[model samples]
Target: MAKLVIYLNCEDARSQAAFYTEALGGEILNMVTYEAGPWSDMPEKDKNKIMHMTFTAGGVLFYACDSIGEPIQRGNGAFFYLSFETEEEAYAAFDRLAVGGEVIESLKVQFWGDLFGQLKDQYGVIWQIAVENTSPSM
Candidate 1:
């Protein structure tokens, strides 16, 4: 089976990747700047920009890169859903990701008996965090 990975295009991939690493308690596995890659002939301004980056957090892996000579159009069609085994983990991650961003929904017990919340990160990415209730009254 083929593996699925999330790839993001942003204005500042390096800063965005760093923010995610800190917020999600993950590490940047690999990163390459345009100047360091085959496209080393890129303009000076873009040379320092990230050409590619790989990071993992809470078992989730992601790829990101800076847009090359193009405008980024952010939409609300997709979001990253994260399900945790514990409320502590879910809450901590939610809080960290909410910094400098908007919280669509604060973490709380939903009708489904799970602790859940939604937010847009500082980098304009949406995320949904949840913790399933081990013992649901239903």
Candidate 2:
């Protein structure tokens, strides 16, 4: 089986890593910064910026880095969905993710018989939290 890990580009990868840790209850595994020697030609402002960061949240490893040139834009037609097995767990996670962020939709029982919600985090990263229903009938 193939594995898929989400990668994100931000203006401040360091801050993003910290926020993810707090909001998603994860830990930062590793972080790399752009520096002299191999990055001599890069812009000065980006010299201290994060080159790469690896974090593990909810058993999933996510990768992030500072944008080289392009600006960081949220709601880029994508969302990172975090699925939970229990409704309580899903609601707790969703509430944490909504702190200081905009909630696109409050958590509620969806038409598909699942508890679902969407929000954009403080760093402009969109997320979807869900707990699927195991019922046999719709």
Candidate 3:
């Protein structure tokens, strides 16, 4: 139905959004910038900034936005998961992603017969990549 994501406010929202779009092959639905406040009551700063953005990748819809006013407290939330169809795909992606990051876990035979690994990307986003060995229908 719906999904949500939080994006840190970086100096360049457009560029950051593009990078993520390319990396995940997600659809960049909207990328717009408007002049500050003469038109709306909201602060002018936010007008030129990315107030919000939406993307759809791999059959999933995700939302992102620029952080405002404060530093985001990192590493206090649940880990995010990304799944690959095959173990090979997962390891390949894991290697590519590890260029600026380190592999928290090298691909290995998981207790469930699938291979899995954990990593924190260059941008500080932690992910758990895995292959599903068991059928969900069971």
Q: What clash pairs does model 1 have? A: none
- Clashes in model 2: which pairs? none
Supply the TM-score for candidate 1. Answer: 0.90
User: Which residue segments of model 3 deviate by more than 4 Å?
Assistant: 1-12, 32-47, 135-138
Supply candidate 3's per-residue lDDT for 68.
Answer: 57
Candidate 2 lDDT over 1-138, as tens digits, reads 998889978888888878778777889998888873385588788788888889987767999988888887676688888889998888888888898999999999988888889998888888899987889256
Q: How many Å off is the CA of 84 in candidate 3?
A: 1.8
Name the candidate that leads on TM-score: 1
Alpha-carbon runs more than 4 Å astray in model 2: none
**Worst ten in a row by lDDT for model 2:** 35-44
Clashes of 3: 2
Question: Over 4 Å off in model 1, which ranges?
Answer: 134-138
- RMSD (CA, Å), candidate 3 to true, equals 3.9
Better model by TM-score: candidate 2 vs candidate 3:
2
